[model samples]
Target: MPQLPCQGCRGMCCGPVPITESELKRIRKYVRGMPLPARSKLEGQLRFFGTCIFYDQDQDKCGIHPARPAVCRAFGLHRNLVCFRMPEAASGEAWAAGEPSVGVLSADFVWNDFK
Candidate 1:
């Protein structure tokens, strides 16, 4: 797979990501496992409205990358989830979720929900 041109994007495309129950559980575990300082820093960062709650704006990457939702993992690779910065990387096939979304991150879910 090609690397996304994410360095300068600051998670501009990570708004309101839909997540399943399993993904939420995984993220809860991932957050709970973080050291207080690391977790605090991540939780303290200010982001643009509508950005994913777990986006580490300071690091310019996903704070819970290892536990990111399925749609995020398939980003820029599926036709329906194309990255505007790298549209050529998207394939013709759409990405299908293995399960239904329980909530939308940064919307139905938030920093408090992960705590």
Candidate 2:
């Protein structure tokens, strides 16, 4: 299996990043019984402070794994994996455990399912 990038730091990419109305609606269906708080910021061409409640602190995984949104499923693809990714660490312990980074997507975190 592919490893989770950025094992040295807590997953920062797990924030409920800003999303579109259609995207929000679709994901909402999956997360039933809970309000998928669409930020008031999506009214314009931009949104600020998009953060999801599903970001797991301990496991470094999305708590809402089953209902992850489209963007959440497709972030940072087809580009050179950035420098911030795969930073050096004292040990590769996190890598062995397979915990995902918060804000960044590992190359293996493909969006093919969504497409």
Candidate 3:
């Protein structure tokens, strides 16, 4: 089957991306030369349930797409892991409509499972 194009999805996959040890290392190295604000944003993303540092909410795209983690690259590519066409939650509209979106992965879901 053909995979759904992820464009215009507003980064639903970003929130659940599992950062592995090696990916963390790569992200650290990549962010070392970035400005303070950018680095700080990345650091903050390390917290559980926070959005991925590379996700640009404003632009709705990955800031570090070229070097994104393996989990990120593999998201929605498999039979059991396909992306869902949920209503956009960029605003409160989806919630206002009484259709609460569900997260694909839990905040405490072990990232090591994918390694």
> lDDT values of the candidates?
0.90, 0.40, 0.51
Q: Which stretches of candidate 1 lie over 4 Å from their true place?
A: none
lDDT by residue for model 2 (78-112), tens: 12222245333223332121232333222222122
- In angstroms, the error of model 3 at 108 is 9.0
Cα shift from native, residue 57, model 1 (Å)? 1.0
- Ranking of candidates on TM-score, top first: 1, 3, 2
Model 1 TM-score relative to the real fold: 0.96
Colliding pairs, model 3: none
> Which of the numbered candidates is closest to the native, going by highest lDDT?
1
**Model 1, range 1-115, lDDT digits (tens) per residue?**
9888989998888889889999999998889899989999999888888888889998899999899998999999989999999999999999999999998888988877877
Candidate 2: list runs displaced more than 4 Å: 1-3, 6-9, 33-51, 80-83, 86-115
Locate the minimum summed-lDDT window of 10 residues in model 3. Answer: 89-98
Model 2 lDDT-worst window of ten: 39-48
TM-scores for all candidates: the values are 0.96, 0.42, 0.54
For TM-score, the strongest prediction is 1
lDDT of 3 by residue, 1-115 (tens): 3445667876666775545456655655655556878645544443324565456666667766666766565455543444566322122311121222222222533333222
Q: TM-score of the candidate numbered 2?
A: 0.42
